[model samples]
Target: MSIIEARSILILILTMPTLTRQGSFGSILSSWSDSNTRGPTISLHAAAKPLMRFMYHRQVLAFIKKNRDTPLSKPIMEIYSSYLAFKHLSPSTKTTILAELDVRIASRADANAVAESLLDYAANLLDSPDANVRISTWRVLAELAHHRSTATAVLAVQPYRRLVELLNHKNVEVLETAVCALAYLTQWPDGAQAAVSPEILSCLVKLLDSPNSGIRRWTCLILGDAAQHQATEMAVSGHLCIGLISLLSESDSEVVENATYALSWITYSSHGVEATLNADILDVIPALLKSPTPQVRRWTCRIIGHIALHKSRASILRLNPCSMLVSFLSDVNVQLRESAIYALSWLTQWPEGAQAAVTAKVLQYLPALLQYRKPHVTKWLRRMLKHLAQHEAMALAAFRTQLVPLVRLGTLVVSSMQGRYSALTKFLMWQTKARLWIPWRGEMGREVNDVFTGMFGGRKRRENGALIPRTS
Candidate 1:
């Protein structure tokens, strides 16, 4: 349960003989090792019981070290690494050995040493004319980093220069493994930000554009996770947001989520959100809102909120930024409706933003709430009404000269509340302060239910419940 134990397990799982076995071993390792122990030191005794117990792997490692010069040394060394992966060996042991290997590989005198010998074998395996060998070598190299930072650093020397040479290899698995290995290698301390070199970025970008959704998703995820401020800068400066936006329509959920999240994060930086606003990219929101997936809609709403919150000028220039949101107040999906309401309220809290909403005639949509059936729908509507009513002067001004459509809908506002206490509370408050804004007419009845019934028709009794007559 220590960092040493976890890293050891990571190394072991990485060296598993077969991919399927690797998965089984990884699950076991993950479950047995707590996240806090994810670094180095400590060890795992293979839980294989009396026959193949892995607890004392140090003995096996000692045997391999002492006999490393023998004819059986090569296979024994490989078996030892595989066993380490199987036992979930500590990363410290792997890193110590890998560092020694790096020094040996770098020294001509020690070029023929066990460390160098193993790496040379790995290199040869990577270059094998056989596709399986190349794929296997790539996997080993990728996993090597979990145990050895030196091996990780060694891969970045050419930073996939040699791997790139083999990219055109006829085998897709080899190509895929090479890319995966490069990504995995880049996670090492030495390879961290260095992995974002021009060549690697180009390769990843190309893969992102590949016809394969899996490749695109993985590539995007890697780039998003590894390349931080730079990627966002490039995305903004190069107008890549458009292409990134298009990826939202990807068939894969992972691709859509990562792409959407990445774009949103990118737009959060200085002048980033402003850039999108300048381009008038708000039109993208409605499509995303209509997405069949709830998560997509939630993220889209979040992105819109981020833009509105970050850009004051953009908010002012866009008088109707939230004009489209009023319709979503009655969405059948409660979560989307909640998110929409939050965005609208957040925008309205800024005085200039409220002024813009008033100027855009957003109040007109309030009259349509009477047509909705859910109490929850009316609940949020009352909240909005109360908020507007609190700003009595702004409300009256927006109501009279600013919102022609709302006025045209008539003064049935007081009657619309009928028996709804929430609506009634807001109506009373509004009338108390804005009496001059109201036009007394007989058609504008005083009873809450009567006003709404006139506009949307009366509720009818049903065996199950009270159901409103739905005109649309």
Candidate 2:
């Protein structure tokens, strides 16, 4: 018997004696019934005290009232009686119960017995030949997969293979639900291990072109989740990255957001980065910059950041994201401006990247970014320009113009007002501000330091009052 059946019988069985004391078993049964047809006769083995039985009856009535308003609650209760009364409830009635169970599972506030019974029976329904049954089964299992505790609980009996098989279901609802269920499974590590296979991943990629915006969005999310792990990322990198990039042009703004998210994770790894570059994903950035939605622009910057990991600034330069991203730095949205700064920071870290920034006309708008008040953006922009100034070309460009002197004045005023400025801090600030010494860190810094050493007689000489080269 299902939990629903057992629970109803338990309620009626426990309350029987109280009714029995009033009259015969027939009268007891009649009182329990609607005075229409006879109710199920469940025999109870133990007897309880009169007061205890009354409380049990009250508890059962309270349970009935609590669930009465839900659409399927009546039939869920009536079904047990229907089975005892030996009547066939239509498929629609059962489906309604399944839908309600879905909501309960989603909210994590399920009736324990009902959920347990559904999990037990849902696997069998996957083979029920009826699409509705399969759809309900998928929905229930998907709901269970939504949470880690329930996902682990149901993993053993979750019909992992059957869920993947439904990806090919002719019914759109079944296919959508199947992909969504599998996507939710990917949230848990074990589920990701089970769901991410060569065949299944290829199937997921196929859904990217599903014409249905919902299907494309869910497919992107599923691939995105699996790609979080290195093993899965290495598995799906090449074709999956290509598929996600192609979706950047999708008319649906949300679809583009999810696709961008997927691309970001997929390309986060060195291997993934290599695969993405091999696929020439840089080709897509120029077009994405044209998207009307700022979110698309925001995520596009993130995607570029991940692809920048290989540190192939030249590869990035060929597509010229420097000018494009610089344009976003002035956007009113703080996030967009930050993303732009972050993307530029990566490109500016190396000499070739810094040169690319200059070549892309970043200097033309370099002064505008200083007006942005977000701390991180300002910091990244400073570092980016610091790296760019190391090229000397950028130094000459800024020093010859009004940019450097104004920035130096601002820094000195802030430092003076803050009351914490020191000799070393002032020297370092002036050096960075004028792009004189690159701070003795990386090859670029060391190279610039070497040049300063040659020009100034020695590094120590500058500390003794021999000033850095005159920008004039």
Candidate 3:
């Protein structure tokens, strides 16, 4: 028996446990490698891993490059070829190879060996019954385009057309790669965009709503990238933005985050943003503010801020669409709270009531924030203080009203600590100082004047009726 075959048998015997669990495939791989050292078996073993891996990856990609006709080796060769192509050089080298391949791809007769090999993978993959293999072929074809823009452009059309056919791919990897390829190809305005038929864009929008986060994220990024000028025209003509807005509350945080960022980009362009506004898709913004992930929350806030700044300036001026943003200030997550603060600050600069709505909502949280002991929490408080000072007219009055309660709580906590936890006492004292209260009682006395004045008008007396000096 050949060395590879014998090794394969040995591995199957000794590593049944590993093979059954698919843990490492190490024994199997080692067996195959051993078998490869033998003459004819070497060729067979070379194609074996590619074939097996292809069964799992389902795409003839950068694994094996043998050109056998069976379902087994073609996929293997496709991957091996890709591996060879990518390994030879960087993006620049790939670009150079692609540049050279373009002239040859123009006609069947003139096609160079490499270009034809790539096309062969593309065509064969499209014809394959396996959706994964077909999707893999599309990826290879798309990568081919990345090098030779000209050849890639020409090559991309058929693959692009073929991609639309695979929209129904059951495999998530296939669907994700296919749409991402389309997104990347269509980035250029020239030939790539021209190749995207109306049906393709429609299919892409459907994928945007796929329960799959990968699909949704890629689709949004693509649609958003394409939503410019003529690309915007094509996207709207195909009805894409509404679907994107629909994803604002997507269950996946990464999807929601990317979708929000993409939507923002799509809206920045005149026609793109106008189309979204005309669709009246503002209602989705508030819900995203409550996204469980901080990244999602931050992106959602930024997007809303962008929309309010540009297309929805009038809507923001009235604070009609920002009620959810005001509510976000009370979110348990500090990052989310700060995002809400930033969003409100930006909106408030334009709208009259925006600042008030934010301050009114945030003041209620001062009691809770005062009790928070984390260093990050203190940093957040400092940011809040800066914000309060910046919008002093709007936030200061509210901060002044709320500060007394917080200080009173802090004092109560400090007073009650009867040496039970010296560390806790030191931390609170540090917080009080970091929070800018050295002479806590003395500082509080002047600060409470505002709170007491609102309660006891004409309070010229300090209990004994001695005139209370205005400390401001």
Candidate 4:
């Protein structure tokens, strides 16, 4: 028929109120395939594909809107079977439907409900032989994985193995989208568990060198999350450490942030720490500590803290990060401040680090942190102050600053015992001093002191009109 006739028919179908109605929608689709309707020529049918796809998309959206306030299971399944599964629907049409669903999944509060219902169909589509279908499916899964409520559901379906398989796909877009899905999925503990396999890590490590910045960024994010697991941390400690450290110098800020975050987790192990040191991570750490991104700085401090927990304090001392870490105590970001305090806490366990921290005036910045209510921040802050108090100069500095009442008590306790205990005893004393201090006057103080004296195998006597514990 004529072009005008086709336009007239398209408008009539689009304007029909019943076109998107429950059962009538399928009848319209069936009309396109039936050969007996008005004897339309082959070219006329071919010419209507775009308009047909548009009508299908419009109907799918209208159907969703009409049912949006209600339970989505029946309507979503209907859309899936009618539009997504129809044999004659073009790949692009299906992709459009999935894309629209992705938008809804991302912006709506009921996204988990939609994702839960769509997971089975989406999982089946992941195995489609069509590359476009696979890419669209990955995008939908990625959006689903973004929600914590739906992330475990995504994991339960076990699509990670299929995602790993796509890492080798020749299409760069497919590889990028696949890694993006893995990046979101691995953020959860269960997802990370599924992602720690040998094949997955190998693919991720290879993608670190991908020419596409997004692949490298997503790969780092996946590795970073996966590296939190003990098995994954040790597995990533080898050559992967070198690859991630190299990415620290990349011009992309996201790659650097994620790479640093992954390194922070990996370096939690002794093996990982040694590998990172051998990789010269220290050389870049100073710069990363000053990174414009708060996350990068926070992760960089975490890397230093993990390394300091090892026997390699001497190596980290050479970096002299105490002043930088101390500076972070005054930072606006509470998390960065927490990370800095954590690193300083580990570093100051050594006498040399304590002295460096004193020289950096860490005491000046610490009093303000006492006002912060975060338990982790307070825990690390207490450790950092206690560590600083172990050294005489730092203790004197704390006394001068009148840092905190507890810190002052630590100073008095440590100073009273100086030259009386062995180095190991002194360290152990500081580690437990917080629990040993008692604020009572008279009998309570005496009893607490006696307990401390007994624990150290010492006897107490008056010296210069003050009680002193003498090791016997």
Candidate 5:
């Protein structure tokens, strides 16, 4: 036999008495009368222990592949069902045996029959006395939760309360895994409904206050997925809006990123929007825009983008993200620049925002962004600037033809441009080289000041143009 096979055989020979529950000292003394017999037995065990240990992990990996084609074979099933599987086996070994019941069994002839038994076996492990067994059990549930068919079978057992109960566990790893298991379950409709139950959502929201940033991050992610269903959103929005929005300023970039994603979906539905508006979420946006992390900034852009897409300036104007969105038109990150202007695409759709766009100098920077190659950015840039020119006479007059294609002058604004041109045009014509006139290092604050003052009555524009503080 090969070396590994010979060593495994040696281990079985030396260890079977102990494994079979008869290797005690009294038993050994009674069983062996001759010193000659015990000498070789003791020496064989001494040699076998290390070899068996070295092969332990390899055996686990090989067992997975060995059972891959027959995961529910009679002997494999017996190993799981046998009392010795749980009683005598080390927790890690029990974990490996539990892992053997993963999604691979879905295609088996008896998959449906074995699924509940496997799920029941795993569900019981959540209360296992050993922490390692509990952690591995969490992994097994998360794996099962990842597939809808097995997830459906798993959920049918009502594992939500048991899993949610672990949200308060003292172990960081357990709490994080529990959140992930719930997050995976939320991928299905029934799973989401069950997860959003009042007790579970309350525990989830309370976790936002967790001292562990990672736990808070995972909680936010679960809420994000949970927010997709309308019933869940209605149930969660009021309770979760403030907690989630507060995390926007979290010091951890990962926590901030996850919090932003959660807030986006939470504020996505009409009910969510209404609840979010009452929560004063808009008050936090200007501060979040200044967040140093790019991912936080990125998802923050998406949160505002979602609002602007659904709600008009009736509420958005109160937040006045228009000027702030315009400021990033000159940012170093191209995607940030694109998000900046794309955010404006919704804001400029309204007359008030169109006017803000004019003050924010969308006209002056229009030429700078026109140089970009990303088609989407270029499209949003043209569309937003077009919205500005349509509403504000100053914006129309500021347009310099040398900067763009005439085709961008769509019918909405172009129809009015016929037989009527504004001061922006007058100033553009006067400056003729307006494109080459503006400097790149700083902003066009002065150029916009001159344009608006000369035509619109300038009291020197508002410096802190924040939308929320101005709300009555």
Candidate 6:
């Protein structure tokens, strides 16, 4: 039968009673099989093609519905095998089949075997002349890359070059899906190494300029995952750093987020840090720090922290991001707060940064962070406070602003301050001694110094017009 005849039969089957429909469908299949006993003929195969496609589609749909809540039975492999044998499934049918496979791979433990079974066939379809087939195939490959076992299986087949080549497809949908597949595939170091050729890197850099935000976003994701490996990190450093920095100004939040995330990972290498600094990333940081997206702000802080590792303190200090970073210490997101504190810890390692931290009133928020039970928060907080304490001016600022809370917690140990006493205790004793002796200065200055010197084994000095504790 032709497609029109097949459709009429399908309508008749649907209009019949359920039992009658089954019997009629079985009879049609039986008649088709009986016809096969004769010599194969063009008319017979042409008539059966659409009928066979419809039958397989119904069987796959029914199988998916029945097994929605359960593991796929072994029969699914047979159904999938027979389904793949049809070389001319419509785009819609191909999409539905691939989508079901994607869902199954994502939700079912046993689906890895199914995915592995389909890997070669799916890889072959990546080059299908039809855009829909290629797009659907890219999506299934992307989903497969999500699982470690299937991801390795996908890598074993080596589709990275084809994925990279598809990035040049004229269709934006194909380009987006191709980039997405690369994004997931590059999550593995080996996969990243395979996918990130010089040509592909150049393509991704150019894609950063794409008007489609999704293309840019997935490109950033690919670069970000590629940057995790040291080899790819260095490879991506100078070439892609500038493109990524430009994306920081993107109107789309997710594009900005992935760009920032990619930059953060890129900054892990010294070469990446150098390239980012050369690209003038500092000028964009203050704006990124104020982004409404918490992830953008968090990763921007991380970029600053990593740049600080390269001793780019002067440039960062010139930008004055310390104030903005300090503001995030009070943010409701714990992870952002942690990233801010981490950035401040690195920034405060120098006197300028310490002064900036003090000028930003970081101490005001320090005590509240102490109440957080998370180890990472406490660790970064302590390091930030320690760096702040290294400078006498910042130390005095902390002493004046947070002394009561620090003393109450009893964990505030200013390594720069002398003697066995806590900095707070020593500062308090010295303050009291000064106040008591001021009235009798002419007669008791030396004697009072000697008294406190013997008691605490240290003395106080006026440095830059600020009282600083001196070690004996």
> Which residue ranges in model 3 land beyond 4 Å of their true spot?
1-133, 142-158, 168-174, 186-196, 211-213, 228-230, 278-280, 317-472
User: After TM-score superposition, what is the CA distance of residue 262 in candidate 4 from its true location, in Å?
Assistant: 1.3
Candidate lDDT (C-alpha), each:
0.53, 0.66, 0.54, 0.75, 0.66, 0.76
All candidates: TM-score: 0.42, 0.63, 0.44, 0.73, 0.60, 0.73
Which digits, one per residue and each the tens of the lDDT, describe model 1 over residues 284-359?
6666766777666766665666665565545533545566565665567766666565556546655665665566
State the lDDT of candidate 2 residue by residue for 1-472, as single tens digits.
9999999999988888553445445566556465656665544433334445455445445644677565444356354233212223344444555665676664554534344455555556677656786788678778887876678766767577787678876668878998888888888777777767877887887888897889899998887788787767778676687788788877798898888777777877877888877777777778887788887788788778776756766677677677788788668887887888888877776776677677767766655666666667766766676566556656556544534344344332344311222222332333443332344355535544554445334443233333443332
lDDT (10s digit) by residue, model 3, range 336-365? 666565565456544254365553575565
What is the Å distance of residue 459 in model 3 from its true position?
43
Q: In candidate 2, which residue ranges exceed 4 Å CA deviation?
A: 1-90, 111-121, 154-156, 355-386, 389-472
lDDT by residue (1-472, candidate 6, tens digit) is 7999999999999999655433334476578676576675568778887888787678778877877777755676556655664676655676777777777777647557667467758755777766777788778888888888778887777786777668887778788888888988999988899767877877887799998988998989888988989868878887888899888887899999999999999998889999998998988998998889999999999999998877887787888888899899889987898899889989988998998888888878867777777767667766776666556566556755675455446444444443223344333333244443331243234443554465446656655534455754
Q: Which digits, one per residue and each the tens of the lDDT, describe model 5 over residues 153-196?
A: 87776778787668778878888888888888887878888998
Count of backbone collisions within predicted model 5: 3
Q: Pick the winner on TM-score between candidates 1 and 3.
A: 3
Q: How accurate is candidate 5 locally (lDDT)?
A: 0.66
Q: Which lDDT tens digits does candidate 4 get at residues 256-375?
A: 998998899889989999999999998999889888999999999999999989968778899899889988888899789888888998998899988888889887775566666676
RMSD (Cα, Å) for all candidates, in order, is 24.7, 15.7, 22.5, 15.2, 17.7, 15.1
Residue 351 alpha-carbon offset, candidate 4, angstroms:
0.3
The worst-scoring run of ten residues by lDDT in candidate 1 lies at 436-445
lDDT of 1: 0.53
Q: What is the lDDT of residue 212 in candidate 6?
A: 90
Predicted model with the maximum lDDT: 6
Clashes of each: 22, 0, 13, 0, 3, 0
